[model samples]
Target: MPRPPLPDDVAELFRRPNPAVVAVLLPSGAPMSVATWYLVEDDGTVLLNMDAERARVSWMREHPEVALTALEEGSWYTHVSIRGRVVRWEEDREKALADIDRLSRHYGGQDYPTRDRARISCWVEVTHWHGWGAAKAD
Candidate 1:
């Protein structure tokens, strides 16, 4: 099935480097969430990268379903929430590095500072989404 498109206002909000949190399911089916850097693709898919050694990476590999919520700068009430699954995993370390650099540039002005370690990149194919506060639909 085709994916649902993010509304224009919500998409615009995502284009900015806002604070985001991602939630993943644990082995026991409990949910764990952490702050993360993310980039939204034109097709509404979300790009997320993590340090290769993190436990969350293992959890993601074992269970692909995830959710992310991005909050507007200085306004927590205004946010966009997305539920999706990891539709693609970039196994190449070089490509993962590039992805981290891209995310770094989006969040900051320069490339990722730590280049000595491997990174894992995944693309979340958004299946459902909604916005609140200013981006909310009337």
Candidate 2:
């Protein structure tokens, strides 16, 4: 499917170094959210990393469905929201570590610390998305 449009402000927000906050719905009907480092791959997939034992990971394990939104800093009304499914998950320690390193370098311009190697990585396929901006009109 074609990717949705990202408002100019929202697109700029994703380019920053600050982590994006994603709100996910748990299988039990509750909501779980987290601030995660992410990368918008050239293929358009959004990659995320988290500890294997994190609540968001457990929620995804039981329910692959999730909603993600990128909030614009210092603004009350600009954001991008996406509803999607977790299409891939790798349990291989080495591969996950490698992916984390790749993403970190892509987003942070550096490699993942050895301490974070135990974390798991997830790849999300966006099914739908919408973006909006709220900057004052001059």
Candidate 3:
């Protein structure tokens, strides 16, 4: 079946580097959540990046389920939570680096710092969402 497209407001929320968190499950069946940067693709899939060798990367590779939350910069009351899975994982060095740079520009004052560590980029398809304000659930 086809997936639903992200609404304009939810898409805008993701456009920001605004505070965001991602939760991935551990091998022990516990949840591991962390703050990070994210973006929305043209098809409404979510984009996230991390160090290629990070524990989260390993966990995600084995178990794609994830829940991500994004909150407005200045308001704690406004937020969006997405429950989904990594639909696409990209390891191409150039593409991965570019994605990180794009996210850095959103949150960081500049492009992501150049580093020797390889990067992994994941595209998440939104399966469900619950939020407030414009992102509010039906």
Candidate 2 differs from the real structure by a C-alpha RMSD in angstroms, to one decimal, of 3.9
Estimate TM-scores for all models: 0.93, 0.75, 0.88
Question: What is the clash count for each candidate, in the order shown?
Answer: 0, 0, 0
Question: Number of the top candidate by lDDT?
Answer: 1
Task: Report how far residue 25 has shifted in candidate 3, in Å.
Answer: 0.3
Task: Give model 3's clash tally.
Answer: 0
- Cand. 3 TM to true fold: 0.88
Tens digits of per-residue lDDT, candidate 1, 42-137, equal 776899999888899989988999999899999999988889999998843766478888899999979898988888899999898778899775
Mind giving the per-residue lDDT tens digits that candidate 3 earns over 31-138? 999998888877878899998888999899889999988998888678888889999998738765788887888677677887678998999989987788666756
Best of the two (2, 3) by lDDT: 3
The TM-score that candidate 1 achieves is 0.93
From the highest lDDT down, the ranking of the candidates is 1, 3, 2
Better of 1 and 2 by lDDT: 1
lDDT of 2 by residue, 7-121 (tens): 4555556555544678787777888787777777665677887777777788887888877776666663766667788888876376757777777787668887775446787
lDDT of 3: 0.82
Alpha-carbon lDDT, every model:
0.86, 0.69, 0.82
